[model samples]
Target: MLKPSIDSLMTKINSKYTLVTVSAYRARRLRENPELFQKSEKSTSVNYVGMALEEIDSEKLTYEVRDKDETTS
Candidate 1:
């Protein structure tokens, strides 16, 4: 079973696609730099991906939604 349940992660990120994308990107960052971890709570997992999920669960990690129109400008 995943430490941070999918249900919990959904609350932090309303869209499933956005959640996966955000976590994946964060996981990649952790892989490159082991010091980018933002979790300060009792960790439930040691892996980079798990760490990213935990950050989301603890509300330590968040994402902003930028309008597509704004990006192409």
Candidate 2:
């Protein structure tokens, strides 16, 4: 079973789209550099996608909300 529930993950992230975006980004990073992030032995059962979700669920990985005006400038 997935350690972090969907509800929990959703709470950390603003929207489902954002969750997917963040998780995908983190998963890609993990694939490129496995040594950068540390995972518990239990995480071995799941693949990188799950690992990424776990990181977000645990608060190990976080995202910042940027104002639209900042990006538009």
Candidate 3:
């Protein structure tokens, strides 16, 4: 079974799309710069994507939504 359930991830994120985007972004970063983020002691995942999900589940990874109007400038 997945360590972080879908329900748990849903609570941290707004939607499944957002969750995928955030996790993908974080996973990319993890791949590029493995030193930037800290891994939890309890994490047993070997791949970056899994690590990303675990981080998100633990609230270590977070995202901010920007309004479209704010980017118009």
Candidate 4:
């Protein structure tokens, strides 16, 4: 089973696309530097992606969606 279920992740991030984007970004960071993980001791996940999901479920990691115009630099 997934450590952090998709349903729980959806509560933290509204859209599936955004959730995937944010988790993937965070997972990459975790893979590059495992030190970025805050729930290492508590998290049951053994991989970076699972850890990223756990972080989202625990509200430890978050993403901000900027205005559309702001992204159009």
Candidate 5:
């Protein structure tokens, strides 16, 4: 077995989902065999592996006011 570089590990963590913890197991597996990762399924909704960074735009979020008519005075 070979050792993985710290830079490679950091890259994986940095690329992972912001709200989720990057799996060490998956990271190691990825480094060991990247082909396996390609065939794997991302069951987690927050998984960022196969997603594009630009897909998560801030403008997509919206907020609404409820029962605010009483404050118009």
Candidate 6:
């Protein structure tokens, strides 16, 4: 019989994770109070059409305003 090392066991433990589904309202609730959930930093790159997120200072933050002026010839 062979035994796995401590590092191998730790790697297995870190590799496994559980995911849960939440409704939009429930998501809002969770977002409003992030301290209630086990938090993790998620890094993602997104290509948006017209809006840009410049800051997120608070739990419920919003982006800045942009002027939309499209002149049709």
Residue 57 accuracy (lDDT) in model 1: 90
TM-scores of all predicted structures: 0.87, 0.78, 0.88, 0.88, 0.23, 0.21
Every candidate's lDDT: 0.88, 0.82, 0.88, 0.88, 0.34, 0.27
Candidate 5 residues lying further than 4 Å off, grouped into runs, are: 1-22, 39-73
lDDT, candidate 6, 14-65, per-residue tens: 3212101112333454456644333224313122100011012112223232
lDDT by residue (9-33, candidate 3, tens digit) is: 9989979999999999988999999
What TM-score does candidate 5 get on C-alpha atoms?
0.23
Give lDDT tens digits, candidate 2, residues 1-73.
5567888998899799999999999889988987756576556435778889888887889988899998896
lDDT of 5 at 63: 24
- Residue 13 lDDT in candidate 5: 40
Kindly give the number of clashing pairs for every candidate. Answer: 0, 0, 0, 0, 0, 0
The list of candidate 1 runs beyond 4 A from truth reads none
Q: How accurate is candidate 3 locally (lDDT)?
A: 0.88
Clashing pairs in 5: none
- Return whichever of 1 and 5 wins on lDDT: 1
Per-residue lDDT of candidate 5, residues 5-72 (tens digit): 33444443444343123344344445566545333133222333322111122112112335878777
